[model samples]
Target: MNNKKPALRIGIIGGGISGVALALGLCRHSHLQVQLFESAPAFGEVGAGVSFGPNAVCAIAGLGLGETYLHVADRTPEPWEDVWFEWRRGSDASYLGATITPGVGQSSVHRADFLDALAAQLPEGITQFGKRATQVDQQSDELKVLFDDGTEYPCDLLIGADGIKSALRNHVLEGQGLAPQAPRFSGTCAYRGMVDSLHLREAFRVHGIDEHLVDVPQMYLGLDGHILTFPVRNGRIINVVAFISDRSQPEPTWPADAPWVREVSQREMLDAFAGWGDAARAVLECIPTPTIWALHDLVELPGYVHGRVVLIGDAAHAMLPHQGAGAGQGLEDAYFLARLLGDTRTDAGNLAELLEAYDNLRRPRACRVQRTSLETGELYELRDPIVGANEQLLGEVLATRFDWLWNHDLDADLTEARARLGWEPRSRGALRQG
Candidate 1:
């Protein structure tokens, strides 16, 4: 009689969307035991808005959490109409060419609601909050995680699903005698806020924004800036993001406390849009208060995992939101790595090789989006000929390839991972959802 344990115990750091999504995926494998650690006091995400294209929605659907997402989120099938452009500083608001579509089906949702849906799917007692990881080191045969309270927990593998500002990443990379590179400012900043659709309707003669535009996504281009607006919470709230150029030195990473910053005045915002269209200026006026973000991007790391520790989501790759795949790519990493770790045969020695393969598969796709996102930002912030050229090129070249982005099958990717990495095979008749 062989009486061995059925599941492999794993420790996951970070409890954001990426971490929670990965935990839910691992839970689907009855042979895997997972524990998640979060630094924050509670489970929630920190952004105002998020866009889930077909690719991301498909990933969530595969996790069996799509119904929850649909219940809590505003599900809109239409994408924003072609991005329009006008010179904000000019006397006349001239029409710059518009971009039709980017690729696939897309929808917008409140960031917190999306995170909550992912966290809700986890079984009770699986997540431990208020446990900030202070240090990561190997203790005997297991990976030891030391928290701020002077306590430690040991596990077979430590998954640093922690976000872009990851403490575990610092411990691992710095411990390897490599100084972690800081995120550089991309010469841009963003002012984000949300307003009621009623206020916007009362403010301007909204031409393109109607009932259809509520579900449809829209980006308006200007000289050295662009504004994107979309619906959330069943089209009850409209989320707006204003992007502009910032030539100053890159600021600190987000979620930082800077007490000296003043509120963005209506006057300052109006000055920024001195010559923009009535529509663009009208939307800016409707904003109550805007949170400014000095846009930043990090250089790609050579590897995602070393030893028994692997990186996922923003911890591995952080990109601009121009492509709208920042969260989607992170979700992809979570689903991909969860499947890799579900294999019973995975061990420390071959773990490096497996991680390298994960990087090989993910890096190019991520890097491409990173670069494309930067270019897209540049195109939207243009105030001259670049804006016209970009719009023309986007209509002629870019929007057609969106179908490929929205319709990816993440489950099939997992199936391939099982075969490629020698993971345990499921019985043909027994299919598991999520």
Candidate 2:
């Protein structure tokens, strides 16, 4: 008689990059049953672009996607320059200062293309479309992911990566005697667009500005806000992200209100930056239609795990995008979780220890990134009185601000964690197919 135990059944909420990556990584075991629920009718993304740093590339590489990811990613224009960032005054385009990233470089890609690449890596029949989870209920032996379709999926573990408006996140918070909370606004709004490279080059030529600005992305700084520009798609396009402290709206944002935060006309954005210099105007003028998003992030959760379920990515710790680490942090989460869950020694009966290990390693690091991202924006907008004191200090501060973030090695971290947690390493070939 066969006396072996059943394989772990893992259910993931959200089919975004993080969720799919986690599922794909875990599926390499072939013993773990991984299913993902995506509320969208099909897998896709609606955003303009994302900035991927070396750490992000390494994290994706851990999933065996480093080369595949490079196909869609463009090496940002910082490799040739000694300094990585050129901070400039938005009024006259006068260079305030610049910061150098000694080793770190970034790759930018369209959000849809990245998402498609991740989805393409996932196998068919694993993701159930239009399945929006309403609530997660944990019983004695199994966890139930209740959906809006009056159906429930039973799983041994749940990973919620459903993003900023996640529905399953409530269960994790509520289990800890905490009231369900939504992401809070940071009194900031962003207008985002992508400008064609040829278009930006012509705009710079017409403005009679140094052509170097297009070669290396520039950050035009001003009072209460900043504009960040970078190249994507092998310098064929420029992604423009503008941040402003918007006080035009009321508190506790309600999306039902017409002309809410998600949508803003190009004229409104132009009006907001009316006094900016030519560079800002040049990029702004190229954006035929601007998409606006009210930046909101989660407060630190008391814990990321509850019983058989856990949270990852934005559902656990969404943050401001000032440092461009929001999605990258999510990727990091998937990397750790996949390795922990896929370990041959890990079994469904001992999932609590696995989850505890995840919380111990991932929570602290992700929260630090969240807080750092917030403070970074403050510096960019000259809100931090100290960083705003002088441009030289600002340049120095920005230069080294992200070194620790980019230099982290997940493999080393995993080794340390195993030692710290008394986990025994197993041979990679030992993973049995269920």
User: Residue-wise lDDT of candidate 1 within 127-241, one digit each (tens)?
Assistant: 9999998888874566888999888878777888887777777665664577775565566667788878777776654554344333455577666777877777777778888
Mark the regions of model 2 whose C-alpha exceeds 4 Å error after superposition.
Answer: 77-84, 102-104, 247-263, 425-434
Tens-place lDDT per residue, model 2, 33-85, is 88999998998876777877677878999987887788888664545534456
- Candidate 1 regions exceeding 4 Å error are 77-104, 175-177, 206-215, 248-263, 343-353, 383-390, 401-416, 423-434
On lDDT, the candidate that comes out on top is 2
| C-alpha local distance difference test of each model | 0.68, 0.81
Question: What lDDT would candidate 2 get against the real structure?
Answer: 0.81
List the candidates' TM-scores in order.
0.83, 0.92
What TM-score does model 1 achieve against the real structure? 0.83
User: What is candidate 2's TM-score against the reference?
Assistant: 0.92
The candidate that achieves the highest TM-score relative to the unseen native structure: 2
